[model samples]
Target: MARGPAATPNPTVAARDGMVLPAAGPGTGTPLAVRGLTVSYGENPAVFSVDADFPPAAMSAIVGPNGAGKSTFLKASLGVIPRLAGEVDVFGKPVEQARARIAYVPQRASVDWDFPTTVIDVVKMGLYREVGLLGRLSGARSTRAMRCLDRVGMADFAHRQIGQLSGGQQQRVFLARALAQDADLYLLDEPFAGVDAATERAIIDVLRDLKAEGRAIVAVHHDLSTVPAYFDHVFLINVRRIAEGPVATTFTPETLQATYGGRLAATHLDELAITGGA
Candidate 1:
């Protein structure tokens, strides 16, 4: 596997808004790094040679068209799907070695909501690493799970069946499950899709809180209008990476045009200019 330059020293402790973040690990300054990542479906390539660096203590948005392989990039980097070629580093270590420090929230649409499980049980799934898959859910662990649910305003529905909840509520529950993991880096796929505005606001607020606590957040975001307001870093991709850097500089009209190709209408570009000052 390929590797980047030697890790540099970072602060042992980070304090923000009266909350002390977890001490940094040996090489956690960069939460995630992908080099020459490529994935394919037989003869067709999904994402090709994508390189990205996700900064710690920041929220980064991955944006592209529907078939641009945004989700493929995330899945391939995490080893969830087979990659033709690439290297993924998490907290300056191989992804396998850093699994405990990362949390993933897959797209809600991809989940089987009809599964016969209660909300609390679903949240407890996040604790499998610490408690073991077949271990009993003790009172303390249950309490912790409830706390995570409460953070997403779903504590009252903890006893309800997952499929019984609304779309927004289900999304919140998934996020709560991810929170229960208490990981240093969070990777979410289309977290705000198919949800109400209030749910979107709540989700973003929690993500911002996590960011303020010095956690790294990376999400496959589709709403271009919200990119400028919700993300500090932006990576634009269409099969391959078009541009990546701070949103203020990299998320310009030119990059958007390049990423979307002819799919983007002139009016949408105009709207992005007015809304994002791109």
Candidate 2:
């Protein structure tokens, strides 16, 4: 039998990420395409016309300095924004129709940390899509929720209050929540923001596993240093597209500077580092 990284065969990915995805069926392997994408806040344009596609079965990192519109782009792709000028297509189909096949992990900082909730209770939200908006949860769904928590090393904290968890632990919970959805496309915004190295590695390992499953991952990441080492595909964007390609090509300093709006000093990068995002 022929084999790709996951030994499926017919897998044709070229991210140079050393990140390989499982063999994906041709029918579900369509990439996420954005053309003439423009997002704005009132009269102030946030993102200019942009064009690109996240190929299926690849890990793509979106990086830039502060105010680069990386998170805005993710919102546009998901139709969460009020008005958008560009077109977003997933697997050559409209994004709205592909909702069930996609999952989203917004920044940990954006969540109401003080809100009263338990770890497992948070993850149970992920199953809502599959169980249905009105679907009652059987024990099966609850079991799956705990299993997902274990996957991210949060099994012990399943009953702990979400506000009490550390930054890294919280981030892992976000990953687990998304995994519980079992979607084909994953869009994460600053998942590693405020996360410790160990937590970062755990999150990365989960993304890698998802890649191995042939799902597409798009992360809004601000850590420029890890872009090359962590992602196979990179999209450097400011208000417009600066550079996009395999990390080997798009992770260069020139592109970094352009994407961040001129040369960024070390101090500036530190400031741009996301602690919490909404």
lDDT of 2: 0.83
Model 1 earns a TM-score of 0.90
Q: Write the per-residue lDDT of candidate 2 for residues 1-278, one digit (tens) a residue.
A: 55656764455565578765544454454568888889999787788898887877889988877887899988988998844688888876788888878899998888788889999999999998788878898899999999999989999999999999999999998899999999989999999889898999888998999999989999998876677567889888888888888887557656665676556875654533431110
Q: What are the per-residue Cα lDDT tens digits for candidate 1 across 1-278? A: 54433542444443767675555466445899999999998788999998999998999999999989999999998999999999999988889888889999999999889999999999999998888867888899899999999999999999999999999999999999999999999999999999999999999999999999999999999999999999999999999999999998888888999999999998999998877774
Clashes of 1: 0
Q: Name model 1 segments beyond 4 Å from true.
A: 1-27
lDDT of each: 0.92, 0.83
Displacement of residue 34 (Cα, Å) in model 1 is: 0.3
lDDT of 1: 0.92
TM-score of each: 0.90, 0.84
